[model samples]
Target chain A: MALIEVEKHEVEEEQKPEPVRVRGLPFFPHFLLREVVVMCLIAGGLIMLASIYPAGLLKPADPFDTPSPIYPEWYFLYVFGFLKFWTWDLGPIPAKMIGVTVPMVLWYGLLILVPFIDRNPSSDIRKRKVAVTLGVIVLIGILYFTYFSIVHH
Target chain B: MTLNDKIYKWLDDRFKLSELLPPIVKHPAPLNVVSNPLYCLGGTAFLCFLILVITGIFLAMYYKPTPAEAYKSVEHIMTAVPMGSLIRSVHHWAANTMIAAVMLHMMRIYFMGAYKKPRELNWVVGISLLLITTTFGFSGYLLPWDQLAFWATKIGTGIAGSIPVIGGYISLILVGGNDIGAETLTRFFAIHVMILPIAIATLLGLHFMMVRIQGISGRL
Candidate 1:
């Protein structure tokens, strides 16, 4: 997200910009074709090897054979794990108040006004200490709580 | 302007690109978010969307998007289609990647203070887009109709059921009954395919406009 500004910042390979001598010969940038090709080949080769001598292994999924440890993907694990840790076991009203409805309402409501909340006009990492701090805290909280769920549970 | 014609001409004369780029950028102020942070994230998300649609269409050629046929179709794709397993894996990996990418994109906006000032509404819309994306992922879980699909969705919809006054009704609406069955499958399918897509597209349009109006915020 604009780590280096394109408009003003000269993100040359080196620390300083090398002068562009206007040589008319069209020199295209070197494409990383070799690495890309090798990766594709490796993936394809592995898949092909598996195809040649198939184990033919597949168990018919039974309706009743519900597997344990039914976790969401690594992503939703944050939310899934959150749900497990913070079940608002306060019946219908409180559950609704804390869980589904409030979370949505608060998140959306807060988001709608974040611009006002952190009224700093700078996206500069140096200037916007408050925003950056908040960002780090949120990121840490998500990862930390998610870790707790996996480790403790 | 037609991109093919513009691009072919531009490649013929890129030295003049700066002039051409701005003249182009200056057009359609709000919603035309070119040359910005929003544009960068939007472009990446677009790329991910392209990956998903193309891979999903390929997957759908063999995918049975129902309970009984879902697992078999996935198996057939893995075993029967040429390089099907790799394709499926790529699709799986790509979906997870897209979610992460979008989340990071949102975080980038959040931290950068791009969500402030004239872009507040857009930020809210962006959050809604985040929710929709996760919803898309959640509904998609059930497409396989495997054990993962069954209980995960059950739990997900159960969360919906936890809402106070209308919790039970919401769960009923989501699951289509006391249990997850055909109705639930069809409902989730409609969301994954139809409703969520439309909502995302609409929000994306608005987000792009707001970004264009606001331009890119700076790091300093």
Candidate 2:
């Protein structure tokens, strides 16, 4: 009976509030609302404002009057730059698919399985230098290809 | 009032305030609230959303989307409107910035290992949101109807026709026919203004909820 009473006392002592290492907020190390709000406002307002005006109508689609040197949007420039390969008029078909579909499929596949692949939980992306480096290299290569295509044409 | 009644009134009023302004009590710091690994991605995305909204409205007063008026309208804004050039420049610069930022945000989530386990579905939703955002960019690009914008979109929608299933249908829907015409502009306009915005907002809300519920993932 004495031993049991002693155990209860120890449990009560352990139950005392411990000092948790937290300051202002639980998640944010330093919260800056003004900057965050400004960023969001700019993004939202652009989309809404740009929504208004488009060249009201398009000329009927004409297969004959081809849009010369057709190109993708700027963001896709890195991929569309692949078009130059088939531009010799030799194999534009494969080049187009290669330019678009391959990258899409590859990225989608990687994204889906990334959790299983990167088992380690690391906050520092740069620490996984091999993988991160490869991504940067790939992006640089793609951008370079785009610039090359532009300059050559 | 009786003493019992007065105490009951005080309790009810106090509890109501707690319910109404819980965040003031829970999270007095915005950074702390936003820093959660789970919430950071979309929260930051929301930050960009607000940016897009502000710059967009400033551009709207001067923008005229019709073909005849497209270039002229832009010209008028640049020349006639106050700070027109700045507004245009800011809009253009910010569009590029958002795309870059969003891509980085996705990368951060990917590297932080936040898109794991229960977060998988949110990842998929996020991917959808990215695609929509890009589409928003593309459709908006065409609004200026500049030589670059025109040809870029022409080529873009052409690519849409390459998809295996419903490729032809998509092309038609996009252009309102095989060729770009008034209908195409109108359709793209509807999509940019009406359809896409609603879809994005809904997806963003759902995406946010998932983030809040899952909480931030642990940092290694």
Candidate 3:
């Protein structure tokens, strides 16, 4: 009986995997060095772009004279595109309300509920087919809408 | 004591910065995430925000909030105010870059499932921060008082006006009246400079604290 117990212990010990050796440098200098390098690159890029093509000052605003194709900044183009697409007449529901609220709620709701919606413990993208698909679809939709808005405008 | 040690002791006695800073400064980042440059988007966004704040302060020195003076002040900055164009351009580009960086960071967090379980609150905080950042952009957009700014604001506020019950009231409050005028400029200016900044800074502190406590999420 004692020999069997010892044999069991030996098997358990043999089965134990090696400790994971995480690959990276210390935080103080190693990570900090990378952070500083990235920050410098961003700064250099900003300066180069700013110097090369200075931001323009458009004509002073005249409330009376609206531009022919007025558009919000590129970031807002997705929302602008949604508003443009959902122009159907709703009797009681205000069009702008539907246009703005629906997209806002849907986009933010998905974002806020992501953790709950994806309960799987695994972080691997391959295992998260549903979540990845949804994310990709949303991203593509936004990009498509933005591009459409730009071209049509 | 040596001169450096004496100076350090003197400062440390007055402000306990020595006690406060080391743990934070030396906190070990997750090896996998830190190894990849992609995970630095949040930090990059933060750097851009800092740049925006500095450039914004410089611009504000000469910026007049009134509708009458707003456009001329921006024009003044562009053409006359020595190195003013560079500063203004930097601010403009920084704002755009900050937005892009924040979006990229959020996308990275989402895909990595970083918001799962214990990190849900941080995710909510992050989304709120994104909203505040967008509001910052919207409010700041109107500051130049140019054609694009004016009409864009009109449409933007009009969207706010479309909210079901309180939309009219909210828009009224935003524009400060029935129409976009001096009051509108002042309100947007106040929001861009004062309100949003305070809100974002406070939320950013919370976000960073949560990230520190939880540590960076594991890579996918």
Best by the TM-score measure: 3
* lDDT by residue (tens digit), candidate 2, B1-220: 9998888679878787547554433432323343454445455556666556676777766776566676677777666887766567556655666676677777767656568677878888887788788888888877766666677777777766765466678788788876665676677767877788789889989987896688655553
In Å, residue A113's CA in model 2 sits off its true spot by 5.4
Residue pairs with colliding backbones in model 3 are: none
Best candidate (score: lDDT): 3
lDDT of 1: 0.65
* Candidate 1 clash pair list: A96-B164, A115-B116, A124-B219, A124-B220, B31-B209
Global lDDT scores for all candidate models: 0.65, 0.63, 0.85
Q: Which consecutive 10 residues in model 2 chain A have the weakest lDDT in total?
A: A1-10
Task: Compose the digit string of candidate 2's lDDT tens values, residues A1-153.
Answer: 011101112234557755443334421222444445645665556545544532222342343455666555567776566645434332545556555554454556676566667655454666677667766787677778778667655
lDDT of 1 by residue, A26-56 (tens): 1111112322353455445434544554322
DockQ-wise, the better of 1 and 2 is 1
**Tens digit per residue, CA lDDT, model 1, B1-220:** 6998789777758676656665343332222232243434545555566566777678778876666777788788877899787666655655665687788888777766677777778888887887888888888777777677777777778877876677889788788888888788888878787788788888888887776667655432
Off by over 4 Å in 1: A1-63, A87-105, A122-127, B1-22, B25-42
RMSD of each: 8.8, 8.9, 7.1
In order, how many clashes per candidate? 5, 35, 0
- Each candidate's TM vs. the true structure? 0.70, 0.70, 0.89
